[model samples]
Target: MERLYQGIVRFRESDYQSHKDLFKELGQSQSPHTLFIGCSDSRVVPNLITQTLPGELFVIRNVANIVPPYRDTNDYVATLSAIEYAVKALNVENIVVCGHSNCGGCNALFAPEETLNAVPHVKKWLEISHGVKEKILREYPDADAQKREWMTEQMNVVQQMKNLLSYPYIKERYQEGKLSILGWYYIIETGEVFSYNKESMEFELVTDTFTP
Candidate 1:
Protein backbone atom coordinates (compact mmCIF):
# COMPACT_ATOMS: atom_id res chain seq x y z
CA MET A 1 0.00 0.00 0.00
CA GLU A 2 2.82 2.39 0.82
CA ARG A 3 4.47 1.44 -2.44
CA LEU A 4 1.31 2.41 -4.33
CA TYR A 5 1.19 5.75 -2.52
CA GLN A 6 4.81 6.43 -3.36
CA GLY A 7 4.12 5.54 -6.96
CA ILE A 8 1.26 8.02 -6.98
CA VAL A 9 3.56 10.72 -5.66
CA ARG A 10 6.14 9.95 -8.30
CA PHE A 11 3.49 9.99 -11.02
CA ARG A 12 2.25 13.38 -9.87
CA GLU A 13 5.83 14.67 -9.85
CA SER A 14 6.96 13.06 -13.07
CA ASP A 15 4.85 11.12 -15.57
CA TYR A 16 1.65 13.04 -14.87
CA GLN A 17 3.44 16.37 -14.85
CA SER A 18 5.15 15.59 -18.14
CA HIS A 19 1.82 14.65 -19.71
CA LYS A 20 -0.14 17.46 -18.02
CA ASP A 21 -1.49 18.94 -21.19
CA LEU A 22 -2.72 15.60 -22.48
CA PHE A 23 -4.25 14.79 -19.11
CA LYS A 24 -5.85 18.21 -19.01
CA GLU A 25 -7.47 17.61 -22.37
CA LEU A 26 -8.62 14.17 -21.22
CA GLY A 27 -10.15 15.70 -18.09
CA GLN A 28 -12.83 17.34 -20.16
CA SER A 29 -13.79 14.20 -22.07
CA GLN A 30 -12.33 11.03 -23.57
CA SER A 31 -12.66 9.64 -27.07
CA PRO A 32 -10.80 6.35 -27.05
CA HIS A 33 -10.51 4.56 -30.35
CA THR A 34 -10.55 1.01 -29.03
CA LEU A 35 -12.16 -1.06 -26.28
CA PHE A 36 -9.56 -3.56 -25.05
CA ILE A 37 -10.91 -6.59 -23.23
CA GLY A 38 -8.17 -8.64 -21.63
CA CYS A 39 -7.56 -11.16 -18.84
CA SER A 40 -7.20 -10.16 -15.21
CA ASP A 41 -3.76 -11.72 -15.03
CA SER A 42 -1.21 -9.49 -13.31
CA ARG A 43 1.21 -10.37 -16.09
CA VAL A 44 -1.07 -8.94 -18.78
CA VAL A 45 -0.95 -5.15 -18.61
CA PRO A 46 -3.05 -3.99 -21.55
CA ASN A 47 -1.71 -0.44 -21.85
CA LEU A 48 1.88 -1.47 -21.22
CA ILE A 49 1.70 -4.25 -23.79
CA THR A 50 0.01 -2.10 -26.42
CA GLN A 51 2.18 0.94 -25.58
CA THR A 52 -0.99 3.02 -25.37
CA LEU A 53 -1.34 6.02 -23.12
CA PRO A 54 -4.37 7.23 -21.21
CA GLY A 55 -7.46 8.02 -23.32
CA GLU A 56 -6.16 5.84 -26.14
CA LEU A 57 -7.75 2.54 -25.12
CA PHE A 58 -10.73 1.91 -22.91
CA VAL A 59 -9.87 -1.34 -21.14
CA ILE A 60 -11.86 -3.96 -19.27
CA ARG A 61 -10.05 -6.79 -17.56
CA ASN A 62 -11.70 -9.93 -16.24
CA VAL A 63 -10.88 -13.53 -15.45
CA ALA A 64 -9.75 -15.21 -18.68
CA ASN A 65 -11.09 -12.23 -20.61
CA ILE A 66 -14.40 -14.05 -20.88
CA VAL A 67 -17.47 -12.33 -22.30
CA PRO A 68 -20.77 -13.95 -21.57
CA PRO A 69 -23.44 -13.97 -24.28
CA TYR A 70 -25.77 -10.98 -24.06
CA ARG A 71 -28.52 -11.59 -21.55
CA ASP A 72 -31.65 -9.74 -20.48
CA THR A 73 -30.93 -10.46 -16.81
CA ASN A 74 -28.67 -8.41 -14.54
CA ASP A 75 -26.01 -11.09 -14.14
CA TYR A 76 -22.49 -9.95 -15.12
CA VAL A 77 -23.86 -6.42 -15.22
CA ALA A 78 -20.46 -4.72 -14.78
CA THR A 79 -18.94 -6.26 -17.88
CA LEU A 80 -22.18 -5.97 -19.86
CA SER A 81 -22.61 -2.30 -18.99
CA ALA A 82 -19.02 -1.46 -19.99
CA ILE A 83 -19.45 -3.22 -23.34
CA GLU A 84 -22.70 -1.37 -24.06
CA TYR A 85 -21.28 2.01 -23.07
CA ALA A 86 -18.09 1.51 -25.08
CA VAL A 87 -19.99 0.55 -28.21
CA LYS A 88 -23.13 2.66 -28.06
CA ALA A 89 -21.94 5.76 -26.24
CA LEU A 90 -18.21 5.95 -26.87
CA ASN A 91 -18.55 4.45 -30.34
CA VAL A 92 -15.19 2.73 -30.10
CA GLU A 93 -14.13 1.68 -33.58
CA ASN A 94 -12.40 -1.51 -32.45
CA ILE A 95 -13.00 -4.10 -29.76
CA VAL A 96 -10.08 -6.40 -29.01
CA VAL A 97 -10.43 -9.52 -26.87
CA CYS A 98 -6.95 -10.54 -25.78
CA GLY A 99 -6.11 -13.80 -24.02
CA HIS A 100 -2.68 -14.63 -22.73
CA SER A 101 -0.59 -17.77 -22.42
CA ASN A 102 -0.97 -19.92 -19.31
CA CYS A 103 -4.16 -18.25 -18.09
CA GLY A 104 -5.37 -19.61 -14.73
CA GLY A 105 -9.00 -19.21 -15.78
CA CYS A 106 -8.35 -21.34 -18.83
CA ASN A 107 -6.60 -23.92 -16.67
CA ALA A 108 -9.53 -23.87 -14.28
CA LEU A 109 -11.77 -25.04 -17.10
CA PHE A 110 -10.15 -28.46 -16.94
CA ALA A 111 -9.92 -28.68 -13.16
CA PRO A 112 -12.64 -30.20 -11.02
CA GLU A 113 -14.95 -27.70 -9.33
CA GLU A 114 -13.54 -28.79 -5.97
CA THR A 115 -10.17 -27.39 -6.99
CA LEU A 116 -11.72 -23.92 -7.00
CA ASN A 117 -13.52 -24.42 -3.67
CA ALA A 118 -11.96 -21.31 -2.17
CA VAL A 119 -13.06 -19.18 -5.14
CA PRO A 120 -16.61 -20.32 -5.74
CA HIS A 121 -17.54 -17.14 -7.55
CA VAL A 122 -14.61 -17.62 -9.88
CA LYS A 123 -15.73 -21.17 -10.57
CA LYS A 124 -19.14 -19.83 -11.49
CA TRP A 125 -17.68 -17.14 -13.73
CA LEU A 126 -15.53 -19.66 -15.57
CA GLU A 127 -18.63 -21.57 -16.56
CA ILE A 128 -19.02 -19.00 -19.32
CA SER A 129 -16.24 -20.85 -21.13
CA HIS A 130 -17.70 -24.29 -20.57
CA GLY A 131 -18.51 -24.56 -24.23
CA VAL A 132 -14.89 -23.92 -25.10
CA LYS A 133 -13.85 -26.85 -22.95
CA GLU A 134 -16.48 -29.08 -24.49
CA LYS A 135 -15.44 -28.16 -28.01
CA ILE A 136 -11.78 -28.94 -27.30
CA LEU A 137 -12.60 -32.30 -25.77
CA ARG A 138 -14.85 -33.17 -28.67
CA GLU A 139 -12.46 -32.07 -31.40
CA TYR A 140 -9.00 -32.60 -29.93
CA PRO A 141 -9.56 -35.64 -27.79
CA ASP A 142 -5.99 -36.87 -28.23
CA ALA A 143 -4.23 -33.59 -27.46
CA ASP A 144 -1.74 -33.57 -24.59
CA ALA A 145 -2.22 -31.45 -21.47
CA GLN A 146 -0.02 -28.58 -22.67
CA LYS A 147 -1.64 -28.62 -26.08
CA ARG A 148 -5.09 -28.61 -24.52
CA GLU A 149 -4.26 -25.63 -22.31
CA TRP A 150 -2.86 -23.62 -25.25
CA MET A 151 -5.87 -24.46 -27.39
CA THR A 152 -8.27 -23.49 -24.59
CA GLU A 153 -6.65 -20.09 -24.17
CA GLN A 154 -6.78 -19.27 -27.90
CA MET A 155 -10.30 -20.65 -28.32
CA ASN A 156 -11.59 -18.57 -25.40
CA VAL A 157 -10.59 -15.38 -27.25
CA VAL A 158 -12.54 -16.44 -30.33
CA GLN A 159 -15.47 -17.47 -28.17
CA GLN A 160 -15.58 -14.07 -26.47
CA MET A 161 -15.51 -12.35 -29.87
CA LYS A 162 -18.64 -14.33 -30.72
CA ASN A 163 -20.14 -13.35 -27.38
CA LEU A 164 -19.52 -9.69 -28.21
CA LEU A 165 -21.55 -10.11 -31.38
CA SER A 166 -24.61 -11.03 -29.33
CA TYR A 167 -25.04 -7.39 -28.35
CA PRO A 168 -27.44 -5.70 -30.78
CA TYR A 169 -25.68 -2.36 -30.88
CA ILE A 170 -22.30 -4.00 -31.44
CA LYS A 171 -23.73 -6.21 -34.15
CA GLU A 172 -25.33 -3.25 -35.93
CA ARG A 173 -22.12 -1.25 -35.83
CA TYR A 174 -20.06 -4.26 -36.86
CA GLN A 175 -22.29 -5.01 -39.83
CA GLU A 176 -22.06 -1.36 -40.89
CA GLY A 177 -18.23 -1.57 -40.74
CA LYS A 178 -18.16 0.98 -37.95
CA LEU A 179 -16.70 -1.55 -35.52
CA SER A 180 -14.14 -4.32 -35.83
CA ILE A 181 -13.84 -7.21 -33.37
CA LEU A 182 -10.40 -8.76 -33.01
CA GLY A 183 -9.01 -11.74 -31.13
CA TRP A 184 -5.43 -11.63 -29.88
CA TYR A 185 -3.21 -14.20 -28.23
CA TYR A 186 -0.27 -12.86 -26.25
CA ILE A 187 2.65 -15.09 -25.32
CA ILE A 188 4.01 -13.78 -22.05
CA GLU A 189 7.35 -15.53 -22.17
CA THR A 190 8.44 -14.08 -25.50
CA GLY A 191 6.42 -10.85 -25.57
CA GLU A 192 4.95 -11.93 -28.88
CA VAL A 193 1.39 -11.21 -29.89
CA PHE A 194 -0.74 -13.06 -32.44
CA SER A 195 -3.83 -11.73 -34.11
CA TYR A 196 -6.62 -14.00 -35.23
CA ASN A 197 -7.38 -14.01 -38.95
CA LYS A 198 -11.05 -14.48 -39.66
CA GLU A 199 -10.34 -15.41 -43.27
CA SER A 200 -7.80 -18.13 -42.47
CA MET A 201 -9.33 -19.08 -39.13
CA GLU A 202 -5.83 -19.07 -37.66
CA PHE A 203 -3.86 -16.91 -35.25
CA GLU A 204 -0.88 -15.39 -37.05
CA LEU A 205 1.83 -13.27 -35.50
CA VAL A 206 0.94 -9.55 -35.44
CA THR A 207 4.41 -8.83 -36.86
CA ASP A 208 3.68 -11.11 -39.78
CA THR A 209 0.27 -9.74 -40.73
CA PHE A 210 -1.91 -6.74 -40.09
CA THR A 211 -5.51 -7.93 -40.06
CA PRO A 212 -6.88 -5.20 -37.80
Candidate 2:
Protein backbone atom coordinates (compact mmCIF):
# COMPACT_ATOMS: atom_id res chain seq x y z
CA MET A 1 0.00 0.00 0.00
CA GLU A 2 2.80 2.42 0.83
CA ARG A 3 4.42 1.78 -2.55
CA LEU A 4 1.10 2.41 -4.25
CA TYR A 5 0.70 5.64 -2.28
CA GLN A 6 4.15 6.81 -3.35
CA GLY A 7 3.34 5.94 -6.96
CA ILE A 8 0.14 7.96 -6.67
CA VAL A 9 2.05 10.91 -5.23
CA ARG A 10 4.56 10.72 -8.05
CA PHE A 11 1.78 10.53 -10.61
CA ARG A 12 0.04 13.55 -9.15
CA GLU A 13 3.28 15.54 -8.98
CA SER A 14 5.14 14.54 -12.13
CA ASP A 15 3.22 12.26 -14.45
CA TYR A 16 0.04 14.24 -14.07
CA GLN A 17 1.98 17.49 -14.17
CA SER A 18 3.56 16.59 -17.50
CA HIS A 19 0.17 15.83 -18.96
CA LYS A 20 -1.71 18.58 -17.15
CA ASP A 21 -3.92 19.62 -20.03
CA LEU A 22 -4.84 16.07 -20.95
CA PHE A 23 -5.64 15.29 -17.34
CA LYS A 24 -7.72 18.40 -17.01
CA GLU A 25 -9.63 17.58 -20.17
CA LEU A 26 -10.16 14.00 -19.02
CA GLY A 27 -11.29 15.25 -15.64
CA GLN A 28 -14.53 16.39 -17.26
CA SER A 29 -15.08 13.40 -19.56
CA GLN A 30 -13.54 10.20 -20.90
CA SER A 31 -13.99 8.90 -24.40
CA PRO A 32 -11.67 5.92 -24.47
CA HIS A 33 -11.37 4.24 -27.86
CA THR A 34 -11.11 0.71 -26.46
CA LEU A 35 -12.60 -1.40 -23.70
CA PHE A 36 -9.87 -3.72 -22.40
CA ILE A 37 -11.18 -6.78 -20.62
CA GLY A 38 -8.45 -8.73 -18.86
CA CYS A 39 -7.59 -10.83 -15.83
CA SER A 40 -7.17 -9.24 -12.44
CA ASP A 41 -3.74 -10.88 -12.24
CA SER A 42 -1.08 -8.27 -11.39
CA ARG A 43 1.11 -9.26 -14.34
CA VAL A 44 -1.40 -8.37 -17.06
CA VAL A 45 -1.77 -4.63 -17.57
CA PRO A 46 -3.39 -3.52 -20.82
CA ASN A 47 -2.06 0.03 -20.78
CA LEU A 48 1.48 -0.85 -19.76
CA ILE A 49 1.70 -3.73 -22.23
CA THR A 50 0.27 -1.63 -25.08
CA GLN A 51 1.95 1.62 -23.95
CA THR A 52 -1.39 3.37 -23.91
CA LEU A 53 -1.84 6.54 -21.93
CA PRO A 54 -4.45 7.30 -19.34
CA GLY A 55 -8.04 7.84 -20.50
CA GLU A 56 -7.26 5.70 -23.51
CA LEU A 57 -8.47 2.26 -22.41
CA PHE A 58 -11.54 1.55 -20.37
CA VAL A 59 -10.57 -1.57 -18.37
CA ILE A 60 -12.52 -4.39 -16.81
CA ARG A 61 -10.59 -6.94 -14.77
CA ASN A 62 -11.87 -10.11 -13.17
CA VAL A 63 -10.65 -13.50 -12.04
CA ALA A 64 -9.50 -15.55 -15.08
CA ASN A 65 -10.80 -12.67 -17.23
CA ILE A 66 -14.03 -14.61 -17.49
CA VAL A 67 -16.90 -13.03 -19.35
CA PRO A 68 -19.79 -15.31 -18.46
CA PRO A 69 -22.12 -16.25 -21.25
CA TYR A 70 -24.95 -13.79 -21.72
CA ARG A 71 -27.93 -14.73 -19.64
CA ASP A 72 -31.42 -13.37 -19.22
CA THR A 73 -31.10 -13.82 -15.48
CA ASN A 74 -29.80 -11.31 -12.94
CA ASP A 75 -26.29 -12.78 -12.90
CA TYR A 76 -25.06 -11.16 -16.09
CA VAL A 77 -26.22 -7.64 -15.32
CA ALA A 78 -22.84 -6.28 -14.27
CA THR A 79 -20.86 -7.66 -17.20
CA LEU A 80 -23.70 -6.71 -19.53
CA SER A 81 -23.74 -3.21 -18.11
CA ALA A 82 -20.08 -2.63 -18.92
CA ILE A 83 -20.49 -4.00 -22.44
CA GLU A 84 -23.57 -1.89 -22.97
CA TYR A 85 -21.92 1.25 -21.67
CA ALA A 86 -18.78 0.64 -23.70
CA VAL A 87 -20.57 -0.15 -26.94
CA LYS A 88 -23.84 1.79 -26.58
CA ALA A 89 -22.88 4.71 -24.34
CA LEU A 90 -19.16 5.22 -24.69
CA ASN A 91 -19.16 4.02 -28.30
CA VAL A 92 -15.82 2.32 -27.97
CA GLU A 93 -14.74 0.89 -31.32
CA ASN A 94 -12.61 -1.95 -30.03
CA ILE A 95 -13.08 -4.51 -27.26
CA VAL A 96 -10.01 -6.51 -26.30
CA VAL A 97 -10.14 -9.58 -24.05
CA CYS A 98 -6.66 -10.52 -22.99
CA GLY A 99 -5.50 -13.82 -21.46
CA HIS A 100 -2.01 -14.66 -20.37
CA SER A 101 0.43 -17.55 -19.99
CA ASN A 102 0.72 -19.41 -16.67
CA CYS A 103 -2.61 -18.16 -15.34
CA GLY A 104 -3.29 -19.46 -11.82
CA GLY A 105 -7.01 -19.16 -12.31
CA CYS A 106 -6.93 -21.34 -15.41
CA ASN A 107 -4.66 -23.85 -13.71
CA ALA A 108 -7.08 -24.31 -10.86
CA LEU A 109 -9.70 -25.59 -13.29
CA PHE A 110 -8.18 -29.08 -13.27
CA ALA A 111 -6.37 -28.71 -10.00
CA PRO A 112 -7.61 -29.31 -6.47
CA GLU A 113 -9.70 -32.39 -6.84
CA GLU A 114 -11.38 -31.23 -3.66
CA THR A 115 -12.53 -27.68 -2.85
CA LEU A 116 -13.64 -28.05 0.75
CA ASN A 117 -10.64 -26.06 1.98
CA ALA A 118 -10.62 -23.45 -0.77
CA VAL A 119 -12.16 -20.00 -0.80
CA PRO A 120 -15.79 -20.35 -1.83
CA HIS A 121 -15.99 -17.30 -4.04
CA VAL A 122 -12.79 -18.18 -5.88
CA LYS A 123 -14.01 -21.68 -6.54
CA LYS A 124 -17.28 -20.33 -7.86
CA TRP A 125 -15.54 -17.78 -10.03
CA LEU A 126 -13.21 -20.37 -11.53
CA GLU A 127 -16.17 -22.48 -12.53
CA ILE A 128 -15.91 -20.75 -15.89
CA SER A 129 -12.89 -22.93 -16.67
CA HIS A 130 -15.02 -26.06 -16.69
CA GLY A 131 -15.79 -25.50 -20.34
CA VAL A 132 -12.12 -25.26 -21.12
CA LYS A 133 -11.36 -28.39 -19.12
CA GLU A 134 -14.15 -30.32 -20.80
CA LYS A 135 -12.88 -29.30 -24.19
CA ILE A 136 -9.43 -30.52 -23.25
CA LEU A 137 -10.75 -33.81 -21.94
CA ARG A 138 -12.80 -34.47 -25.05
CA GLU A 139 -10.32 -33.31 -27.66
CA TYR A 140 -7.14 -34.53 -25.99
CA PRO A 141 -8.36 -37.27 -23.76
CA ASP A 142 -4.84 -38.71 -23.48
CA ALA A 143 -2.93 -35.45 -23.53
CA ASP A 144 -0.02 -35.06 -21.17
CA ALA A 145 0.30 -32.29 -18.58
CA GLN A 146 2.05 -29.80 -20.86
CA LYS A 147 -0.41 -30.33 -23.68
CA ARG A 148 -3.40 -29.90 -21.38
CA GLU A 149 -2.07 -26.66 -19.93
CA TRP A 150 -1.28 -25.16 -23.32
CA MET A 151 -4.60 -26.17 -24.85
CA THR A 152 -6.61 -25.03 -21.83
CA GLU A 153 -4.96 -21.63 -21.92
CA GLN A 154 -5.64 -21.37 -25.64
CA MET A 155 -9.21 -22.62 -25.56
CA ASN A 156 -10.05 -20.48 -22.57
CA VAL A 157 -9.47 -17.40 -24.73
CA VAL A 158 -11.88 -18.67 -27.36
CA GLN A 159 -14.56 -19.62 -24.82
CA GLN A 160 -14.37 -16.23 -23.17
CA MET A 161 -14.50 -14.48 -26.54
CA LYS A 162 -17.66 -16.38 -27.40
CA ASN A 163 -19.11 -15.45 -24.01
CA LEU A 164 -18.46 -11.77 -24.72
CA LEU A 165 -20.65 -11.96 -27.79
CA SER A 166 -23.56 -13.47 -25.92
CA TYR A 167 -24.75 -10.07 -24.74
CA PRO A 168 -27.54 -8.67 -26.92
CA TYR A 169 -26.03 -5.23 -27.10
CA ILE A 170 -22.65 -6.63 -28.11
CA LYS A 171 -24.23 -8.92 -30.69
CA GLU A 172 -26.32 -6.12 -32.16
CA ARG A 173 -23.39 -3.73 -32.37
CA TYR A 174 -21.18 -6.41 -33.92
CA GLN A 175 -23.77 -7.25 -36.55
CA GLU A 176 -24.19 -3.57 -37.47
CA GLY A 177 -20.37 -3.28 -37.72
CA LYS A 178 -20.21 -0.87 -34.80
CA LEU A 179 -17.78 -2.97 -32.73
CA SER A 180 -14.86 -5.36 -32.96
CA ILE A 181 -13.69 -7.94 -30.38
CA LEU A 182 -10.10 -9.11 -30.07
CA GLY A 183 -8.68 -12.05 -28.12
CA TRP A 184 -5.05 -11.97 -27.06
CA TYR A 185 -2.48 -14.03 -25.24
CA TYR A 186 0.27 -12.06 -23.52
CA ILE A 187 3.30 -14.24 -22.87
CA ILE A 188 5.00 -12.78 -19.82
CA GLU A 189 8.33 -14.58 -20.00
CA THR A 190 8.88 -13.87 -23.70
CA GLY A 191 7.47 -10.33 -23.51
CA GLU A 192 5.51 -11.11 -26.65
CA VAL A 193 1.81 -10.76 -27.31
CA PHE A 194 -0.10 -12.96 -29.72
CA SER A 195 -3.52 -12.06 -31.07
CA TYR A 196 -6.14 -14.69 -31.92
CA ASN A 197 -7.67 -14.11 -35.32
CA LYS A 198 -11.38 -14.89 -35.42
CA GLU A 199 -11.52 -15.70 -39.12
CA SER A 200 -8.47 -17.94 -38.96
CA MET A 201 -9.13 -19.00 -35.35
CA GLU A 202 -5.41 -18.95 -34.72
CA PHE A 203 -3.07 -17.07 -32.42
CA GLU A 204 -0.67 -15.29 -34.71
CA LEU A 205 2.41 -13.37 -33.67
CA VAL A 206 1.41 -9.75 -33.09
CA THR A 207 4.43 -8.74 -35.15
CA ASP A 208 2.26 -9.03 -38.23
CA THR A 209 -0.33 -6.70 -36.75
CA PHE A 210 1.88 -3.86 -35.41
CA THR A 211 5.35 -2.67 -36.35
CA PRO A 212 6.25 -0.40 -33.50
Per-residue lDDT of 105 in model 2: 81
Best by lDDT: 1
TM-score of each: 0.96, 0.91
Clashing pairs in 1: none
lDDT of 1: 0.93
What are the runs in model 2 whose C-alpha is more than 4 Å off? Answer: 75-77, 208-212
Residue 29's C-alpha lDDT in candidate 2?
A: 95
Query: lDDT per prediction?
Result: 0.93, 0.83
| lDDT (Cα, tens digit) per residue for candidate 2, span 26-93 | 98999999999898899988889999989999898887788877777655456667867877889899
